[model samples]
Target: RKPKTLLAGVSGRARPGRVLAIMGPSGSGKTTLLNSLAAQMDKAPGLVLQGEVYVNGEICNQSMASMRKGYVRQEDTFYSQMTVRETLRFVARLKLSPEVPYEDKMAVVESLIKKFSLAKCADTIIG
Candidate 1:
Protein backbone atom coordinates (compact mmCIF):
# COMPACT_ATOMS: atom_id res chain seq x y z
CA ARG A 1 0.00 0.00 0.00
CA LYS A 2 1.13 3.55 -0.50
CA PRO A 3 2.32 5.29 2.63
CA LYS A 4 -0.39 6.69 4.86
CA THR A 5 1.07 10.15 4.74
CA LEU A 6 2.11 10.95 1.20
CA LEU A 7 1.49 7.89 -0.91
CA ALA A 8 -1.74 7.03 0.77
CA GLY A 9 -4.33 4.71 -0.85
CA VAL A 10 -1.82 2.93 -3.10
CA SER A 11 -2.01 -0.79 -2.48
CA GLY A 12 -0.04 -3.89 -3.36
CA ARG A 13 1.78 -6.73 -1.66
CA ALA A 14 5.56 -7.03 -1.82
CA ARG A 15 6.43 -10.62 -2.59
CA PRO A 16 9.15 -12.53 -0.83
CA GLY A 17 12.43 -13.18 -2.68
CA ARG A 18 11.92 -10.20 -4.94
CA VAL A 19 12.61 -6.48 -5.18
CA LEU A 20 10.23 -3.53 -4.93
CA ALA A 21 11.25 -0.08 -5.97
CA ILE A 22 9.26 3.12 -5.45
CA MET A 23 10.16 5.66 -8.09
CA GLY A 24 9.16 9.31 -7.98
CA PRO A 25 10.46 12.82 -8.21
CA SER A 26 11.62 14.82 -5.23
CA GLY A 27 8.89 15.68 -2.69
CA SER A 28 6.91 12.70 -3.86
CA GLY A 29 6.85 11.47 -0.25
CA LYS A 30 9.13 8.53 -0.98
CA THR A 31 11.29 9.16 2.07
CA THR A 32 8.25 10.04 4.11
CA LEU A 33 6.68 6.74 3.17
CA LEU A 34 9.81 4.89 4.32
CA ASN A 35 9.92 6.84 7.57
CA SER A 36 6.33 5.82 8.25
CA LEU A 37 6.94 2.16 7.44
CA ALA A 38 10.06 2.10 9.62
CA ALA A 39 8.30 4.02 12.36
CA GLN A 40 11.43 6.14 12.42
CA MET A 41 9.57 9.34 13.06
CA ASP A 42 6.24 10.42 14.45
CA LYS A 43 3.51 11.01 11.92
CA ALA A 44 3.69 14.54 10.64
CA PRO A 45 1.80 16.66 13.18
CA GLY A 46 -1.61 14.99 13.44
CA LEU A 47 -1.23 12.19 10.88
CA VAL A 48 -2.06 8.63 11.85
CA LEU A 49 -1.88 5.17 10.28
CA GLN A 50 -5.30 3.57 10.35
CA GLY A 51 -4.27 -0.05 10.05
CA GLU A 52 -1.84 -2.63 11.35
CA VAL A 53 1.58 -3.29 9.83
CA TYR A 54 1.85 -7.03 9.39
CA VAL A 55 4.87 -9.29 9.00
CA ASN A 56 4.00 -12.85 8.02
CA GLY A 57 0.40 -11.93 8.91
CA GLU A 58 1.27 -10.80 12.42
CA ILE A 59 1.01 -7.20 13.47
CA CYS A 60 4.11 -5.08 14.09
CA ASN A 61 4.05 -1.74 15.76
CA GLN A 62 5.80 0.24 18.53
CA SER A 63 8.56 -2.40 18.85
CA MET A 64 9.31 -4.09 15.54
CA ALA A 65 8.60 -7.79 15.91
CA SER A 66 10.94 -9.00 13.15
CA MET A 67 14.32 -7.68 14.18
CA ARG A 68 16.01 -9.86 11.57
CA LYS A 69 14.42 -7.72 8.87
CA GLY A 70 17.07 -5.03 8.90
CA TYR A 71 16.60 -1.44 7.83
CA VAL A 72 19.36 0.15 5.75
CA ARG A 73 18.84 3.90 5.64
CA GLN A 74 19.63 6.14 2.71
CA GLU A 75 22.49 7.90 4.51
CA ASP A 76 25.39 5.50 4.43
CA THR A 77 27.90 5.50 7.28
CA PHE A 78 31.34 3.95 6.91
CA TYR A 79 34.42 3.74 9.07
CA SER A 80 37.51 4.86 7.19
CA GLN A 81 39.27 2.09 5.22
CA MET A 82 36.82 -0.59 6.27
CA THR A 83 36.11 -3.19 3.60
CA VAL A 84 32.58 -4.39 2.97
CA ARG A 85 33.18 -7.61 4.85
CA GLU A 86 34.66 -5.81 7.82
CA THR A 87 31.80 -3.38 7.99
CA LEU A 88 29.19 -6.11 7.63
CA ARG A 89 31.02 -8.25 10.18
CA PHE A 90 30.99 -5.38 12.58
CA VAL A 91 27.30 -4.80 12.00
CA ALA A 92 26.46 -8.49 12.25
CA ARG A 93 28.42 -8.69 15.47
CA LEU A 94 26.42 -5.89 16.95
CA LYS A 95 23.06 -6.81 15.45
CA LEU A 96 22.90 -10.50 14.53
CA SER A 97 22.38 -13.41 16.92
CA PRO A 98 25.72 -14.25 18.49
CA GLU A 99 24.43 -17.79 19.13
CA VAL A 100 24.25 -18.37 15.37
CA PRO A 101 27.33 -19.80 13.69
CA TYR A 102 29.47 -17.42 11.64
CA GLU A 103 29.09 -19.44 8.46
CA ASP A 104 25.35 -19.56 8.84
CA LYS A 105 25.19 -15.85 9.38
CA MET A 106 27.45 -15.23 6.42
CA ALA A 107 25.29 -17.51 4.31
CA VAL A 108 22.18 -15.64 5.32
CA VAL A 109 23.86 -12.34 4.56
CA GLU A 110 25.11 -13.56 1.22
CA SER A 111 21.72 -14.92 0.34
CA LEU A 112 20.15 -11.57 1.01
CA ILE A 113 22.65 -9.82 -1.24
CA LYS A 114 22.15 -12.37 -3.98
CA LYS A 115 18.40 -12.07 -3.76
CA PHE A 116 18.80 -8.33 -4.00
CA SER A 117 21.22 -8.62 -6.95
CA LEU A 118 23.92 -6.82 -4.99
CA ALA A 119 26.66 -9.40 -5.73
CA LYS A 120 28.37 -7.32 -8.43
CA CYS A 121 29.58 -4.94 -5.73
CA ALA A 122 29.43 -7.28 -2.75
CA ASP A 123 33.10 -7.06 -1.85
CA THR A 124 33.57 -3.39 -2.62
CA ILE A 125 34.53 -1.13 0.26
CA ILE A 126 31.69 0.95 1.65
CA GLY A 127 33.80 4.00 2.41
Candidate 2:
Protein backbone atom coordinates (compact mmCIF):
# COMPACT_ATOMS: atom_id res chain seq x y z
CA ARG A 1 0.00 0.00 0.00
CA LYS A 2 1.20 3.53 -0.77
CA PRO A 3 1.40 6.18 1.90
CA LYS A 4 -0.83 9.20 1.68
CA THR A 5 0.58 12.54 0.60
CA LEU A 6 0.09 15.37 3.09
CA LEU A 7 1.16 17.98 0.54
CA ALA A 8 1.12 17.99 -3.22
CA GLY A 9 2.42 20.29 -5.94
CA VAL A 10 2.84 23.33 -3.65
CA SER A 11 5.29 25.96 -4.82
CA GLY A 12 6.13 29.58 -3.92
CA ARG A 13 8.84 32.00 -2.96
CA ALA A 14 9.41 34.04 0.20
CA ARG A 15 11.68 36.99 -0.32
CA PRO A 16 13.46 38.87 2.40
CA GLY A 17 11.58 41.77 4.06
CA ARG A 18 8.35 40.29 2.73
CA VAL A 19 5.87 38.54 5.02
CA LEU A 20 4.02 35.41 3.95
CA ALA A 21 0.97 33.97 5.59
CA ILE A 22 -0.45 30.48 5.10
CA MET A 23 -4.16 30.28 5.72
CA GLY A 24 -6.51 27.37 5.23
CA PRO A 25 -9.17 25.35 6.95
CA SER A 26 -8.19 22.61 9.38
CA GLY A 27 -6.60 19.52 7.80
CA SER A 28 -5.89 21.46 4.64
CA GLY A 29 -2.16 20.64 4.71
CA LYS A 30 -1.10 24.06 6.00
CA THR A 31 1.08 22.63 8.75
CA THR A 32 2.36 19.95 6.44
CA LEU A 33 3.47 22.53 3.91
CA LEU A 34 5.20 24.65 6.55
CA ASN A 35 6.93 21.63 8.07
CA SER A 36 8.20 20.62 4.67
CA LEU A 37 9.43 24.13 3.94
CA ALA A 38 11.22 24.29 7.29
CA ALA A 39 12.57 20.71 6.91
CA GLN A 40 11.18 19.83 10.33
CA MET A 41 8.68 17.22 9.34
CA ASP A 42 8.56 14.13 11.54
CA LYS A 43 10.15 10.97 10.20
CA ALA A 44 7.36 8.60 10.87
CA PRO A 45 7.41 5.02 9.67
CA GLY A 46 5.83 4.46 6.25
CA LEU A 47 5.85 8.20 5.68
CA VAL A 48 7.61 9.58 2.63
CA LEU A 49 8.01 13.32 1.99
CA GLN A 50 9.04 14.50 -1.43
CA GLY A 51 9.87 17.86 -3.06
CA GLU A 52 12.57 20.43 -2.49
CA VAL A 53 12.81 23.38 -0.11
CA TYR A 54 15.07 26.28 -0.94
CA VAL A 55 16.48 29.16 1.09
CA ASN A 56 17.97 32.21 -0.57
CA GLY A 57 17.70 30.34 -3.88
CA GLU A 58 19.87 27.52 -2.53
CA ILE A 59 18.47 24.09 -1.85
CA CYS A 60 17.87 23.67 1.87
CA ASN A 61 19.84 20.56 2.77
CA GLN A 62 20.75 19.39 6.27
CA SER A 63 24.30 20.69 6.17
CA MET A 64 23.57 23.78 4.11
CA ALA A 65 20.50 24.98 6.06
CA SER A 66 20.83 26.88 9.32
CA MET A 67 18.30 25.76 11.90
CA ARG A 68 17.16 29.25 12.80
CA LYS A 69 13.61 29.02 11.56
CA GLY A 70 10.73 29.06 14.04
CA TYR A 71 7.43 27.22 13.70
CA VAL A 72 4.49 27.94 15.95
CA ARG A 73 1.74 25.36 15.80
CA GLN A 74 -1.96 26.17 15.66
CA GLU A 75 -2.32 24.78 19.14
CA ASP A 76 0.49 26.37 21.09
CA THR A 77 1.74 24.38 24.04
CA PHE A 78 3.12 26.18 27.09
CA TYR A 79 2.73 26.11 30.83
CA SER A 80 -0.86 27.11 31.41
CA GLN A 81 0.00 28.82 34.68
CA MET A 82 3.05 30.68 33.44
CA THR A 83 2.56 34.25 32.30
CA VAL A 84 3.35 35.18 28.70
CA ARG A 85 6.43 37.10 29.76
CA GLU A 86 7.69 34.14 31.77
CA THR A 87 7.07 31.83 28.86
CA LEU A 88 8.92 34.08 26.43
CA ARG A 89 11.75 34.55 28.91
CA PHE A 90 12.11 30.82 29.42
CA VAL A 91 12.20 30.18 25.68
CA ALA A 92 14.73 32.93 25.12
CA ARG A 93 16.97 31.55 27.84
CA LEU A 94 16.81 28.09 26.34
CA LYS A 95 17.06 28.94 22.64
CA LEU A 96 19.28 32.00 22.58
CA SER A 97 23.06 31.70 22.32
CA PRO A 98 24.80 31.16 25.65
CA GLU A 99 27.13 34.07 24.88
CA VAL A 100 24.15 36.44 24.74
CA PRO A 101 24.07 38.50 27.92
CA TYR A 102 21.07 38.40 30.26
CA GLU A 103 20.18 42.01 29.59
CA ASP A 104 20.33 41.54 25.85
CA LYS A 105 18.07 38.53 26.06
CA MET A 106 15.58 40.46 28.15
CA ALA A 107 15.72 43.30 25.70
CA VAL A 108 15.02 40.96 22.82
CA VAL A 109 12.07 39.52 24.69
CA GLU A 110 10.68 42.96 25.39
CA SER A 111 11.12 43.98 21.78
CA LEU A 112 9.29 40.91 20.62
CA ILE A 113 6.43 41.53 23.05
CA LYS A 114 6.08 45.09 21.84
CA LYS A 115 6.49 44.21 18.19
CA PHE A 116 3.74 41.62 18.49
CA SER A 117 1.50 43.92 20.51
CA LEU A 118 1.58 41.40 23.31
CA ALA A 119 2.02 43.98 26.10
CA LYS A 120 -1.67 43.85 26.92
CA CYS A 121 -1.30 40.23 27.99
CA ALA A 122 2.38 40.05 28.74
CA ASP A 123 1.73 39.29 32.41
CA THR A 124 -1.31 37.13 31.84
CA ILE A 125 -1.25 33.34 31.93
CA ILE A 126 -0.66 31.80 28.50
CA GLY A 127 -3.73 29.66 28.87
Top lDDT model: 2
Model 1, TM vs. native:
0.46
TM per candidate: 0.46, 0.59
Separately for all candidates shown, the number of backbone clashes (residues 3 or more apart, or on different chains) is 1, 0
- lDDT by residue (1-127, candidate 1, tens digit) is 5644445574457787777787689888776666666776474665665666665566775566436454566676777577666666677767788898888878777777778887787778776
TM-score of 2: 0.59
> What CA root-mean-square deviation does each model show from the true structure?
7.9, 5.4
Top candidate by TM-score: 2
Give the C-alpha lDDT of model 2: 0.81
lDDT of 2 by residue, 14-43 (tens): 666677899889989887787676665673
Each model's lDDT: 0.68, 0.81
Determine the C-alpha RMSD for candidate 1 after optimal superposition of all C-alphas: 7.9
